[model samples]
Target chain A: MAEMYSTPHEILYYEADVTGKLSLPMIFNLVVLSSTKQSVDLGVGPKFTHENGVGWIILQEDMKINRRPVDGEQVILQTMAKEFNPFFAKRLYRILDQAGNVLVDVDAFYTMVDMEKRKVARIPQAMVDAYQADQVKRIPRLAEPTKFEEGMEADQVQEYAVRFSDIDSNQHVNNSKYPDWMQDVLGADFITSHEPTAVNIKYEQEVRLGEYVRSEVKIVGNTTLHQIWANGTLSAEAEITWTEL
Target chain B: MAEMYSTPHEILYYEADVTGKLSLPMIFNLVVLSSTKQSVDLGVGPKFTHENGVGWIILQEDMKINRRPVDGEQVILQTMAKEFNPFFAKRLYRILDQAGNVLVDVDAFYTMVDMEKRKVARIPQAMVDAYQADQVKRIPRLAEPTKFEEGMEADQVQEYAVRFSDIDSNQHVNNSKYPDWMQDVLGADFITSHEPTAVNIKYEQEVRLGEYVRSEVKIVGNTTLHQIWANGTLSAEAEITWTEL
Candidate 1:
């Protein structure tokens, strides 16, 4: 497929993670925004979402981080549908550096929902047709995380109750807000002065309304990592390396 | 000089105005984030900021908005130093769409400060050398605001006391937090359901600690459109169009 449509964006400081590269949650949010625009350009913009009072809700996500891209590095994010069923759709994505080197790849699953009922619904034919028609060329699917690696238990752990402001467009705790779990574990002093050099994270599950997730941080020599889990299932995990300023 | 580096960002829903395009404050925040990174990559980064016990502060800004870019549209933001004087450094920036169309151009002055004394100070030699030597090319001088915009008048406008969370990394109001000013002007119901479309705003001045500024918003034509103003002077004037649903 031709480029069809493309938008540009600049990375900001708040968007940067430990490695001083953009954080995974931020990357996820961007994927969502870009995909929404692509949908609109395909004439599906806000039809089912606004007119029918329905929207896509991310039920699950499996992502892997190969390498961290530094702050101020220009890159492109492209999205296209991989497959769709009556209830769910699988989408593929790639993050590339300015020279077109693949930085990260993601495969996401989404379900349609009735906003008022807050229940999953069948995918609208019109919506699927819109994305399928505008589907950009697909990139290879991202590496999915293996079962939890041994010795991965956190070295330090902290907990936080979700605040009202933490919710995102979907009215759920934003995927990116999970990083605050790590930041809280690192404590204010460490974060205020030190910059993370790189970070790799995966969102295996999500923390829902009014619930608190424990953010655990582990140290292995110079590298510090963190993760959040609810009940026994992993929610998100991240590795951060800090440098003295 | 050749471009040393640039970063790509995807627009988020929270960043969008009612028009579904990104808002001026959101774009401004993007520039601030990019400029900070430029300073860092130039080797000035946060080293000089810490050494001086002060940080970069945006003193005044004058910007022009030609067109608005919608949410999910990737728009490249480019930044460069225009001139470095004794106490202040002038920077110029441009926001471009995929075809490299300029959506907005900004010219503003930033000053180094003594955080302890709350006073402006000359640019340190080390800082100047760091930015000048970096490969990001400098731009030509910029145009001044065409009209005479006044600073806030002491009385007559509605007043708001700043909140603790309002202070951002630099200890000032997180630039984006000001849009809540418009929300303050409207009833709660309008904000919960209606979405904002297009907005035009200018940051004429800054509000500091212990200072309260007045807010004024005027409805134009329909309740959906508003002309918002702050303080006696036009701290910022915005046109917000809302979408029901």
Candidate 2:
């Protein structure tokens, strides 16, 4: 069994939307931060990657929100490694209120990549051991994100020039920014009337600074499919389901 | 003397730049959050404004960074109301490391506004009393931001559509996003080699959702001047001085 790590966070005003509940992007940010903190403590984080010239890149992620924490609410963010192989790893995350009620659950898949070669690489044994990733656990699989068909026309399309603020320490667009771009495509009216219940995303390419990316969204019923294209290349895709608030 | 509030923050990986040091926009976010927290505790926050139909709006702000905290560092964010008049209020903010070393200092000026009228309003006596603003105290003044000439051409200009993610509970673009937009105009090379030492900015108009704003930058030695225009109307202006790191 892998060790679980937990961190406490108070939802700041900036983290909430007009509805006074935590925004989807801010929720994703909290989960990512918590996971990074745990990885750093477990000795499989940036330090290890820098020394080995290999790094972990997230392949897919999906999250379900049971209840959203509001401004000034303190919640515990917890994460644990569920499974790992030479090529891929799976992790689990949960956010809980003080009363122990679960607020959100997330499942994420990651793979090792050679920084210099720009290709998938085998995970080093030491890295796997550090995270106790050999343990097998029964983790429920999240819904798979839909891939938009090539040449499919989108109902809404918006272009964004990747700004410096979007880039993180890795010199690439942070994964959390992808969800923000997708949510923006929904516009203010749709977002205000509905709240996200589930989100699934898959990363295909890296978005770099000073580059322009086009976001396309196709809505059908309660689910929305999104695709992000940098230049002419598909960078990422996602599926989100919303429920009326 | 008004009470000072302090909150501890662990610098998240997403808040830092490629150098692993805190980014300018993140630093501003921390200060703003701290100030908001303090105001809420003092009974002059959003809740109070909602009840009174009057709210505070930032007029100008300036920050000086002495050191930048890196990822995994735990720092203390502190703020206090320094001075207040019938028409304006001044607040002070400081960021200190665990060892009590000051990392950043900021001064911000704000004025009350009528939410319904969309115009500046007098600070109500009851609201001022709630914050204990009668006590006069001397506070250092920050450098005033320079205003650009109407006919001056910008060296570089970029347009950005205000996305839903950029809007706050007030249904307008958050003030912090303005600095992010201005910083993006500097490009990667300049940002990589230089660190911001001082920043001064003035807000003139509110930017609403679905609007397009143009960011313009002018460089002179170590200082850069910035202006944001919404449909040919000046919305905000700023000046930032950078030191080679």
Candidate 3:
């Protein structure tokens, strides 16, 4: 089995909101950071991907936030590769406070893709062997995100021009940015009064640089449904449930 | 003399751009983080500000980027409290790669402000004493950012509504987010082709929640002039010089 990788991070001022708790988007960014660190440690990082002409693309992620650490608090982020199949890999993440109290848990699914062809590629046995990832016949599944219905009207629509800062090394918008678009569509007042308790996101298409993406948000009770469209195609969809603060 | 506080940071994938080099805004955020760490170490962090009902507000910052570090690279961020007078404090930052090569240098000025009144306040003598800040009477001054001429038309004017992600614990937009706005106004093509060599920003007013701030960009040769307006009043201005990559 692959060893769990843990990284310590201090909650910086920029990472926290007015309530002093870590923001959801920042938490997602930290998850990505920790995952990348684990890949580097497992010898499947950017260097390996660049050499092999293959890259890992996240397909879906679901996270439950039990508690949001505040600024100046030091927390540990631990991740482990659960299973790797022919085309998909599953990973789990746990975030703990200084006292080792679990603050958040996340499950992420990824697939190997050919960088040039942009098609799903088989996960090489050698790579999986290198990680010594757990071999599980049945991987636990997260709740599948529902797509926005055809011709469904949105309560609010917001437009964002993809900027240089939004694109990652893959020349596409970073997955962590999708939450920002969703949060922005909810506006400031709604966000300030409500705190996200859970989030589920499924990335369908890549958002390229210079693209103008539209985020459509539909609010039902405490849950917000988000659909992102670029060039008339749905790029991503997400569901976020919030608690009144 | 207070010993310089140095923090080690690994360049995460999210901090770097498509070129694998750290983005300018991320670099600035690192500087802020380092500075905050130093303040905490010196017993003048957020807790102190909360207790005293006063906080440091950055007035202006100037930075020179020598070399941008790439993802997975380990670097050291060092900061020093240079000087503190009655109203203002000066700080300096140096970012060095693992090889001890300086990657960037920055200087920033700040003043204490009453959180409730939102007006400048005198720097308490006890706080300065606690920091053990340098007593240099002649604090080095950064180049003053030239304000955009009144009634001058901009080449591009873009509006961005302040979102949940933009507001920090201070209930105002984080200073680092301003650069992203400026870069967004320039679009992806300009940023991908040019690298910023130097930046000088002066914050004149605070941007509140739900405000639609307009960023006006005027390009002249290698230098770009930026003005951010809210409610028809100039909130901030910046000057950035670029080098062709």
- Local error of candidate 2 at residue B170 (angstroms): 1.8
**For residues A140-222, what per-residue lDDT tens digits would candidate 2 score against the true structure?**
45567876677777988889988888888777998888988998988888889988999999888999998999999998888
Q: lDDT tens string, model 1, A1-245?
A: 22334455555555555345675457766666667767777777765477877888664445445555665567677777776777777676666777777666666767688878888787777876766633333423434433335467766676655533345556666765665566556654566466554444566565665566777777665466666877666777666556655
Superposed by TM-score, candidate 1 places the C-alpha of residue A222 at a distance from the truth, in angstroms, of 10
Better of 1 and 3 by TM-score: 3
lDDT of 2 at A142: 54
Cα lDDT tens digits, model 3, B12-65, are 777888788998778878998898887778788878887899988998989888
Pull out the clashing pairs in model 3. Answer: none
Per-candidate DockQ values are: 0.09, 0.76, 0.71
Each model's total of backbone clashes: 20, 0, 0
Ranking under lDDT, best-scoring first?
Answer: 3, 2, 1
User: In model 1, what lDDT does residue B17 have?
Assistant: 51
Arranged by DockQ with the best first, the candidates are: 2, 3, 1
Instruction: List TM-score per model, in order.
Output: 0.54, 0.95, 0.94
lDDT per residue (tens digit) for residues A1-245 in model 3: 88788999888777887778888888888987887787777787778887888888999989898899998889999988889878889988889998999898999999999999999988777678877897666666678876567588998998887777789999899897899899888887788799888899999899998788999999889999899999999998998989998
State the number of backbone clashes in model 3: 0
Which stretches of candidate 2 lie above 4 Å from their native place? A135-143, B134-142
Looking at model 1, give its docking quality level.
Answer: incorrect
Model 2 has a DockQ score of 0.76
